[model samples]
Target: MHPTIPGFTYRRVPVADDVTLNVAVGGSGSPVMLLHGFPQTHLMWRHVAVELAARHTVICPDLRGYGASDKPAEDAEADGLTYAKRTMAADAVALARALGHDRFALAGHDRGALVAIRAALDHPEVITHLASLDVLPTLDTWDVMHGTGAAVGFHLYLMAQPPGLPERMIGASADAFFGHFLDIWTRDPQAIPADIRAAYLAASRASVPSVVADYRASAGIDVVHDQADRDAGNRLRMPVTVLQQDWGTALGFDAAERWRAWAPDLRHTTVSCGHFMAEEAPEDVVKAVLDLLTR
Candidate 1:
């Protein structure tokens, strides 16, 4: 059987036309929606979800095109819109509404953070609190990424290429491609047990194209939408918190300052953890989320 949070009830909730998300809901109280990142599924939130569920009804869902969620076929002409964060953000909002929530706290890691950012910007009325773990806004990300420093993100550029090549390349060695991030992005290897690691690889292997489409959107249409928001001075109108590895100096940008421009009431913290903070340093993540909820 696939790994799942022990006490959560699972459901396939329709979020869009011909698309439904695989969701795990547990606990009761104020609702909080959690979105999982790439190379992982909603199970990534198993630890955090359980902890948060003690006081809040936690909703964890595999974002569209990832994990067990629906992956709609994308026509070439769609121009990455099918997997754009805006599209995924809408799916998150829809999922929350279907789950009997009109507005809720939102938190995401990596790719999911991008979707959370877009959701906050587009549906401010629906997101009451926001937390982004280890990522910048799409526009800020592309802006700060440059030169040899950008080499760390080789996968980003790879998936950004026009459809076929990326799909074929990643599909050819799906395990290695996805496993590389899983292996290197964590400091506490024990945080993800053998079964969990296998589950992640298996899920990623099966969704190579959809996963690439998700990343490709970040490099293309996501940037455009973020740029449009920036041009209009649109920012997240909610209590926002961000957690990240202290790599801003190496990347030649002030992480907190960058986030401050977008999130006026932002609480940005630099942690000594790897990219998968939610799994590796779940207590820290939980504390941050709990604090944000109070704000």
Candidate 2:
């Protein structure tokens, strides 16, 4: 068993479709759910979870295709299970309800952020506050990366390729594939310990198809949902905070300005840390969430 925080204990609970999720529970007041990003697990939030558990009921879970959860194969030809963010978002909502939190604060990183946004939009009654780290909504992300921005996000396009291709290519050198992001995305490499890095690579290697399917869903079905929301004039109604890298200069679009369109009560800022802000700059992330919740 992992060492428990002063107020939190680890728990494993089943969610939608008989999929059991490994979760860490801590703190007391209002419930707060944390969803981790790609190449990482709930363990990524060890530091932040404990800190938040001091004041709130912190609930951290390994997202659907990531650590310890079921990884159903994708049938990209049809709108398969992996193609829908709604399925993943439903898992989160069910997980929260299983934990007795009808409504709670929610935060997610990278791929997990996509799920968090869907949860807030589809089940606003269940998400009291929302925070997304290092990602824009699906359609806006695709819209911004037209020319040079697309080059920087080559994986986004590469992963969108036909099923067997991306899975085989990425699976061939999983360590290098996952490690490349870990090295380039983080301003501080030492934030993730060597053992943890190895574990991430191993888990990623074992789940190549699932990982590829996740990105593929972004390009296909997820974009459809995002566009539908745009056409419907939908926006997040709850308080929202977004922390991202300074992709403005690099990607040629102002991140804050773009997010303001979707979240009117948004507190968007670009941090100096790399994509793994929660692990690399835990204090800043914690402070940002606290400030947003209080606001």
Candidate 3:
């Protein structure tokens, strides 16, 4: 129920046996799927989707364990991991196919950006274009966060811990923990409306375990998947656009250079806004996605 994206309808799409994604779909044209990140749901795309809807069919979904989507508990015995980005990326591909979109432009922010990268790599034939906002590749990100840099991404370390403790600590005060990012990530607190912020907090609180599992997989199993891809020299062949803050300078790497390694056909630049770039600076996001489509 994103009031801003008028006429959009919500549906529960079954992407897997145990996973059903809550999706908001509208518009009618070349399709474009937008995915949200941590602490927020598909609602983050309200503004951008509305504008895109004028020329492209816009689909926004609460990625499996976020928003109003089904929250499946972690089953440790399911091989080494359950919430890997590969699993989440599968959901994105299935969701689009289920909606009759065999090929579409794809864009995502934060956690969703990671999923989009995985999707573009895994299902490039279906995802014609790719856009990632405010993130580095998961492998590069982990490399940067080791040692003293770990303090900057304390949440990454915390969630990477074995399931029980991180879940308990976060669940104890989910609102405070999730809300802390909402306050700090945005240069302007007014960028996200009060109601939207409340919705994000509520969703995070309700999906604590699923969300934590998502992070846990990133810390453990996700690295293995990324390494295998890098070792095999599997790079993203599709045209890609990445809009992000220049955190690389702080982390001692050329952000664009790192991205160029994976995205061979790439457009990488730093946007002026904060982590919630899509919402904090919707026009910039829309323009970037449009540029990706145009390319």
Candidate 4:
């Protein structure tokens, strides 16, 4: 029972033959896209999308393996190509163009943010502005994940292991695993309404293999992609704004510095919220997105 933004109509956008993204569209004006992260779908942007829709057209899509989108199984021979952010980002670009939006402002949360990062790097001409919530580039994410902060994201490492084992283990208690993050990553548990939590748990339970493969890809091929970007000196050239908690302070790294190296025109700030900033701090997130558009 994942309800979309009130005034939005949900549609299946064909991105590839085997891949069709579940997208919610509403309002009218310059387009703005919102992407959801792990264990959730386009519904994660419900609150933010509605508010933004008043002034700008809103497009919210469930990243490939999550929500109602097509979940292609793990492809060992494909070398994690199915769930790589590069491909996921391409899906977003194709979705935008399919809807007659050649360019738009974009913002994504958590895993969705990772996809947006890749999209901006690859399609800077299409992404006029970018905003990332509670995440770093894939490479820096692994780097800062070390030290005491590693405990906070143990699931990342767990899911990163060989696909089969992680899939079975997570599938065994999918609701518990999904609920665990919802409870811990918010300042106010009420931030995530009960129905929303239940929907996320249900969606995650149904796509265990794809979810695990998504993370597993991050550990393998995703790293290779990020490393390639670093070596080639490719950076996000669009105006970028990042809002995050002070994880670097607790995790023993400088969050802003890591982001600055990748986003040359970066506006990074520390916000007072937990990992789920879009849900826990919607006002802050909305303001940041609007600001990114202006910047």
Candidate 5:
């Protein structure tokens, strides 16, 4: 059927070379692109898109290898055209451009949040405003958490395993494997309905290898990009808003301060939700995005 959000139409649009993305577009006004995270689809923005669509054109897209998007086999040295953050960011940029938006406001959840950050850094001319949900920068995430705190992010390590292992293991019980994160990462289980959860599991299961490849690239090539940005002193010049759980207190960091190092005009807040803030707290997520756009 459809996602939890009511009265929205789904369409698949070709974005980059050899790739097309499943995107949900509705409402009418200034464009706002919403990118979903790991193990989820554009459906994650169901609630938030419905509300934002009332006043703005909401474009939600499933990133490559995640939902309905084309999942190319992993090629480690694909000449900068793999599922890494840079390529994924290009896909988003192409998607927006194909949708006739030279510039747009962008908000992303979890893994998508990392892509959004890279988009802002790499394609500053096209992204006007930026918002990240429930994730820190790649370098910050890897650097800040250690010991037991790092253990909580076991998926990162698990997905980083050599080819065929993670995919084969996760594929054995795909639903349970993907569902475990959905069940534990969110404070509100009711946020994602039964049918929607089933859809997520199905999509995630079919794309296990690609999913692992995406994460694997992050630990390797993605970090290279992040480090380059750090070395170049590149920072997000646009107005940036971040809504996340208070991982800083648990991991010994001042989250806002760390983000400020990357985003000079940043507004960071810790919400009362778990990792899936967009699905769990859609209204707040929408409000945060709209506020950033307005400011």
Candidate 6:
């Protein structure tokens, strides 16, 4: 059995025909769902979930095609929409409803934040509040990347290629590929214990293809969806909070300004931490989530 959030019960909740997310739910009071980032599972929120559970029901789920959750096979000819944020976001909503929540506050980190953004955009009625850790919307993400600075996201361009190559290459050395991020994107080396690091690598190694598909969709269909929303002038109606590393000065884009366009009632904070904020700075993350909920 995988390491789980203490006090949270685990279950497989069906969100789609062939997809059931591995979910860890605990606490009571108002409901708040926490989505985990890439190369990790809901266990990433083990620290924060336990803290938030003191005053709120916290639901954490291993997204479809990730962790111990079901990974639906996609043929080579597939369009990559299967792992798109729109689809993934729907899975989040369905999982919440399956757990009897018609409306709840939502928070996500890294890749999971993309799904949370799309969920608030597409189903505003279902998400009462939103918190995104370390990510911009799809359209804004592509807009900010250019020249040498964009090299940081080499994996994005790598996986954005036409299917076969990215999957084969990543699958070939899955541990090293996924472990690279866990090593470098962390400020506090001890933030993730040896056991948790091993769990991340193991889970990521087992789901390479689906993980690649998830990123590939981010580069393709997700961009299209965000563009359409931009053209339509759709914005997040709920209160939104964003916590991110100070990447603007290096990347040459106003991170908060970009977020302000989508989130009107927004609190954009630049944290002194690495990409894995939940693990590296769980106390700060929990504070931000609690503050957002109060808004």
Model 4 misplacement above 4 A = none
At residue 190, candidate 1 shows an lDDT of: 90
Better of 4 and 5 by TM-score: 4
- TM of each candidate vs. truth: 0.98, 0.94, 0.97, 0.97, 0.96, 0.98
How good is model 6 by TM-score?
0.98
Q: Which lDDT values do the candidates have, in the order given?
A: 0.92, 0.84, 0.87, 0.88, 0.87, 0.93
lDDT at 152, model 6 = 91
- Give one digit per residue, the lDDT tens place, for model 3 in 1-295: 5343577988889999998999999999999999999889998998899989988999999988898889888888864356888999889989999999889888989899988998888887888999999888899998766666567788998998887999999999999999999998888788888899989998899999999889988877788889999999999988999998746456676778889999889998888878898888899888888888988
Which one wins by TM-score: 3 or 6?
Answer: 6
Return the clash pairs for model 2, or none.
8-26
Instruction: For candidate 6, write residues 197-279 as lDDT tens digits.
Output: 99999999999889988998999889999999999999999999999987748889899999999999999998999999999
Model 2 quality (TM-score): 0.94
Q: Report the Cα RMSD per candidate.
A: 0.9, 1.9, 1.4, 1.1, 1.4, 1.0
- Relative to the true structure, candidate 1 reaches a TM of 0.98
Full-model lDDT, candidate 1: 0.92
- Indicate which candidate wins on lDDT: 6
lDDT of 1 by residue, 1-295 (tens): 9999989999999998889999999999999999988799999999999999999999999988888999987757887889988999999999999999999999999999999999999999999999999998988988988999999889989998988999998999999999999988888889889999999999999899899888888888999999998899998889999999878467788888889989999999988888988888999999999999999
How high is the lDDT of residue 94 in model 4?
96
Candidate 3, pairs of clashing residues: none
lDDT of 1 at 120: 97
Candidate 3 residue runs with Cα over 4 Å from true position = 1-4
